[model samples]
Target: MASITPWRQLLLDSIQANKHLRHSEYFQLATVKENGRPANRTVVFRGFIQGTEKLQFTTDARSQKIEEIKTQAFGEICWYFTDSREQFRIGGFLNVIGNAETNPLRLKIREQAWFQSSLDSRLQFAGPSPGIPCVKNGPDDNTTPKLDPAEGPVENFCLVTLEPQEVDYLNLRKMKRYSFVKTGDFSWTQRELIP
Candidate 1:
């Protein structure tokens, strides 16, 4: 049996214990042009694949992010655990979950959660018809709509799979400040830093 390093074990523990990190927002940075100029935006993480060690996210087929992914398969995702004062950064190639005909299982879970919450509000936003604007910046600023979780568009969503080849873990502590860079499949190198 192979022995796992302490840092590797800690990293896995943090992900497993939290299941999802709050401060760490998932974003995909992809190259748009040949010059390598990239575009990035925040994305919701669905879950992580245990066996393959890949992270999952959802997006719309019409979204620019999807186009970026198509043009450039490489990207990076960052997650900062505020409560734990730690940051996790992963870099890898992205693969779109094809089969547009079939609804994604991840989206199904998200849809069920949204449906159970506020049927009316969600239906209004996600319905075939357009929804009313919820936000008002000024007397005439009716364009900005307030976010209604219930009114999310389910059909417009699609899943993105990110299989990380490298991950960097940074722990922000006055003492015992540590950073671990995991390269390749399952190997990692730890470095101690001055806090």
Candidate 2:
């Protein structure tokens, strides 16, 4: 039997590891600010695109991150599974799937994603827009006036995709780490690192 290359193995591991951790799918996303600083925030890891290193997530169009992304598309995602002591740092560029007029496919994807969202999730957007002050005695508070998921693909809905150029995986359990960088079409370069 032949062994798979290091890069392929890393891809396989990432795809699998992310699948079973649905309930705990939060990762820290780091982006560069215009003032030459870094911004880090917690974002849910939606899913991965098969045959590619594209990661998916949803964000509000009014979110400050959207402006940051528009200004600088490059960002990084850090996933640390606390229980397993496994971590992955993914570096990539952002792809904002905006309104239907801009990207029809992204709109459809947003629709589908919305279709799958829970009432609780939909209610989040129904409240205050991202990064806005709470509406005094209004719907600004979370968990009020639940909205149907079917009603969305709201004006604020936006799909954000991460096109990963490199992935660094560290398995502290075994005390090993490596990085895989995409070099070309279906090609990657893997380098072991001292952890």
Candidate 3:
């Protein structure tokens, strides 16, 4: 058996150790527009496509971010690991995860989880609904509403894919960093970086 390189070891460790990173906390995604300007937002990571090395996240179909990606297929993702004092910046092409017929199951699951986690009895009817005025109500009036996983807001869901072409890792311990560009399948061209 062959030994794992330090870079690969670090990446594996970071991914496995933190379950939060597996969700939508550390992903800072940036997408460009046809005018060459950039739009960025913090997105939640839904899952990874193991075979193609693609990262997945959820978004709204009518969101400005998705519209921007439609104009530009390239994007960048920044992942910061506070525990390891490391930051990973991945730049790659953007891909939409579904077709006209097929729905994004992964994104749906994540959305359901997010909805369930954020449910307050007082805020059950607080979503976007016609004729529902947008005004702050008293806490007593904001009772948590029951969420039906099958009947929640599913029409607005979508998934964004990030195919990393370049990944740069910065380590705060040694004040060292390494940059990796996709060279071949499961392989990369690595370069050392200045502190």
Give each model a TM-score: 0.57, 0.82, 0.68
CA lDDT of each candidate? 0.58, 0.75, 0.65
1 or 2, which is superior by lDDT? 2
* Clashing residue pairs in candidate 2 (N, C-alpha, C atoms within 3 angstroms): none
Number of clashes recorded per candidate: 6, 0, 8
Compose the digit string of candidate 2's lDDT tens values, residues 1-195. Answer: 324446446645655665676644788999887786889999987765444557788888878888889779999998887656778888988988766446665567777777666667766666666676666666544455556544756667777888878889898898999988889756678889999
Q: Could you give candidate 1's per-residue lDDT for residues 2-60 as a string of tens digits?
A: 35555546666666656566534444444454456767566656555434566776555
Q: Where in model 1 is the C-alpha error above 4 Å?
A: 1-12, 15-35, 101-156, 174-195
Q: Rank the candidates by TM-score, best first.
A: 2, 3, 1
Q: TM-score for candidate 3, please give it.
A: 0.68
Error of 2 at 7 (Å): 5.5
Model 1, position 50, has a per-residue lDDT of 38
List candidate 2 segments past 4 Å from native.
Answer: 1-23, 135-146
- What order do candidates take by lDDT, descending? 2, 3, 1
